[model samples]
Target: MKQAAQAREVDVLVVGAGVAGLSAATAAAWSGKSVVLIEKSDTIGGTAAIANGSIWIPNNDPAIANGFTCDLESQVRFILSECWDGFDESQKWCGVSKETFLRVDRYVKSGLRVARDLTNTRVQTFTQLDKIFKRYFFSTKDSVDSVRQALGPNHSRSDDELAKAACSSWDYHWENKFNKVPYGKHIWAAFDLRLAGKFFFSGFRKHLWHIVQNMVSIRSLSSLADQIPNLFTKFWGFGSGLILVERFRKHLDRQKVPILKRHELVAVATNGDRVTSVDVQTADRQTLTWKIRDALIIASGCFSHQLTGDGVQDSYSVKSSCVAPGNDGDAIRILKNADVQVNQNPRPVLAQTVIQLAKEKNAISHEPVFYFYGDSFFLVDRHGRRVMNEKLTYHDRAQHHVGNAEQEFLFLVCDRRFKERYWGLGIAVPFDQKHMIVGNNESTLHEEIDRELRDNDCDFRLADNFSANLRETKIAFNEFARTGDDREFGRGKNAFDVLGYMKPDRDHDAPSRSMQPLAGEELYACIYGLSTFGTHGGLVCDEDSRVLNSAGDPWNNLYAVGTCAASFLNGHYPSHGMSIGTGMVFGYLAGLHATSNTKRL
Candidate 1:
């Protein structure tokens, strides 16, 4: 039987405890409002906790400190260039609509403010990423020198090639016509290495002392350590999304904000044009209601959880999302219930190409296949056609899989040299030999694939003409490699295509580091599929972060931020940390506006 709903009153109610929700609650609490933050899951940090803890803020303080000035106009232009869809400037198209210009303008202007607020308030501290290659991973002395030698000004290369590569390495959309700004916007949550080292040593000593004091507990050390929740190695990691959330969580706790975890937003009750209250369901199945005195901000994330059958797969043709399990479109349902209009972007799912593998007997795993180690490898369709530029951003590369509905899977074909180089790249999870399809030569490779298909014993299925098409494809690839020109997909034309991952060796002599002829005798193929970050489209929101109704009117006490609202950039992903950064920007705006003294409707 359903329990009667217990009622409570609050000045501001923030849903979902992800970066955006936490940001909103923090802003509201700082504004002296009585705010209550809730999370559907037991854990407070959502997908943001598992992410790389970076935020892309234009004209951020760190960048300014580094003497890289990114003006507001340039920020808008850069975003528009990234979202360009062949529309004229007067149409104000950043891919969504004419109003996208306004949204982008607001995002660019307010993003820096949000960053400063978070920093000044000690909610989160950020470090500007200055080096081009450092944007992806933690920079080491060896790596810095390697990249500098490979693409440094003193290197022997034509002006045009050098210039293009430099631009590509730093900016993903540098090739776009509208992008004219210098790159220096991305920043990551600052982590103190010295402090982390101290914590690590302390935790290590505590564990060792405990084991030594209790001689009989030596055999059970591993089990006891497991109960302690990663005390030994947790502080040692450099980049972690949990660090970002932890900072916000600590700030909120200090501000006396009530963070109710294991409490799911059930429904939103609204008056003619304003949200009145929200129903919530506790983990223990107790129903509760919160009457909104000021406003309710819905920052609940995407509808990507698989088992919930939230219709995201059917709606966006997406599979295997890496977001949190609780992001099951709770925000969308509540908004729809309140008669708010939710919109969809043409490309709603932000995804990456992933290889699905069977880790154990019955366990399935999806591993990202973003970088191909050397020029020997290329992604191909069922008929052995080159899938894409391969160097394109992961989000752009995933789009190729859905182009042909009949083409259910893509294959990564590489020689032995490529495989060895890839394995040496120091991936966190070692590639399992069971997922590989091997062949001594092209003919044997074809024969092996044919055998697998006939026996229905493989994860990937190729077309019958794969063998014939592969021969032609190999010749074409070799020709492109020899001439240092990928006329078909233009793979090596971009700087990021070369310097984004591992830095080129100083003694490397290939015409293009991103491309080299396939010389190794043995060949291998791995299956690839689509894996999403999260859904990008949701409730339509204005510049102030107010959720809008079908009539294009704002609901006075309702706002949506993060993945719950249609993103400002529409469907375009402009570099790393964009999703999290924009979410925080809007969340800040929502918190500020929702708490302001406007006539209650």
Candidate 2:
């Protein structure tokens, strides 16, 4: 039997405790509204906690006030150049309204203010980018000199050659496997492989190391860098979702605002086109209807399998290892049922790629030869076949691959060099020689294999059929080692130059060069899947953070911020800290919008 419905009233009920939702709640509370922020999860922070905690604000933020002066117009032009397809028409003739622009501006400023207070450091958006670049890239000659000293004279040449070989191989492998595939149509399909390798090897790893070093060195500096600030301010809890939720909760607590967690919104009771009240399910399963006399704001997330059968019917499951599990998209489903239009674009804002490389060295010599399997543009197996499209939404990929590919099993066939460089030569093998093989020990590798299988809920298989796969992979690799003709995928072009330069076999005769350790004496063949940060793209909203229906009409009290909304920038251009920045800015806008509307009433 269903429980009787309860009743309550508040100025606002913000759903989802992600960074954006929390920001909205904080803004609304600060504006003196009775706010009730609800989260489906036991705690909040969302994907922001797992992230590096950088907010990419394009213009001059508080940190780099004197370091650099940015012309906003120039920066905007650069962005437009990259996103000409969408911006060319939309930006002309005042397509972006002044009201939306002002709202975005105000939101950004507010976020900066919040960041300044939390970190206790004068940091502007530009300064953050500068800090990141200086820490990671060779901005100064001294930094390059230090890298050279560590790597020795051959570092530049060696690294560049390895990159070149890898890039060439990647391109060749991708085209041979994917070009003729019907769905492989996007230009990015050709570039993704090179981009992924470059970002991981050159960008992400280097930047991460630099940031860690900066954190340690900040104390030594005489200035305010000594005070190591919280990695995430405003948001609280341990994970990404939790941190943002905590920050928002704290803000509301300070303002004496009420919050009800674990309360699920069941339905929207509407009068004509406006939402009059929302029916919610409490922890005890009792229904409670809350009246919204003035306004309503829907910050619910997108629909997932847990919320709708549509997701399950399409084989789309929630397989994110990183995102908050509670984001099943119930809120989105309810809103959609209530005649609220939703944007269901098949593309994801951010896509992830994973590659499996073999790390093994020659038996007689200690030289390493890392063998990377997978095309430059798309993640593929040894047979040179595109596994997924560069822009297929992650949901589509996850749903398609999960539980089907023996999720946990991976076989890494390697030579000796890989053992010496990455892993100390204490090799291990499993008792079942058919399924697991190591030239050395038997227990340790078995244990690792077992653990992986258990974690992914999968079974293990032998490498009996690996010979065919290896033959295909070896053909691609050997071709690059000889001719350097990457006709299949086109390696030494555009962004791929970064990867091309990392090859070990490339000629390093040039005086000015950067080298990567591509020719280390290691070769291994392994199977792995891409680890994702989180999903991007949800509700579509205007610059003012107002949720727009499919017909281009505002959904009276509906709003979205953060990952729940389509990103303003193109999907390919990944700028660090942008997601967090968007969450905070949009959250602030939604809050202000709700507050102002309430005031007028």
Q: Give TM per candidate.
A: 0.80, 0.57
Q: Which ten residues in a row have the lowest lDDT in candidate 2?
A: 181-190
Across residues 334-390, which tens digit of lDDT does each residue of candidate 1 receive?
666567778754345544333333222111222344445346777778787886887
| Candidate 2 deviant stretches above 4 angstroms | 1-7, 74-86, 89-245, 303-321, 350-380, 384-522, 530-537, 569-573, 597-601
Give the backbone clash total of model 2: 67
Best prediction by TM-score: 1
User: What lDDT would each prediction earn against the true structure?
Assistant: 0.64, 0.41
Q: For model 2, what is the alpha-carbon lDDT of residue 133?
A: 28
- In model 1, the Cα lDDT at residue 109 comes to 83
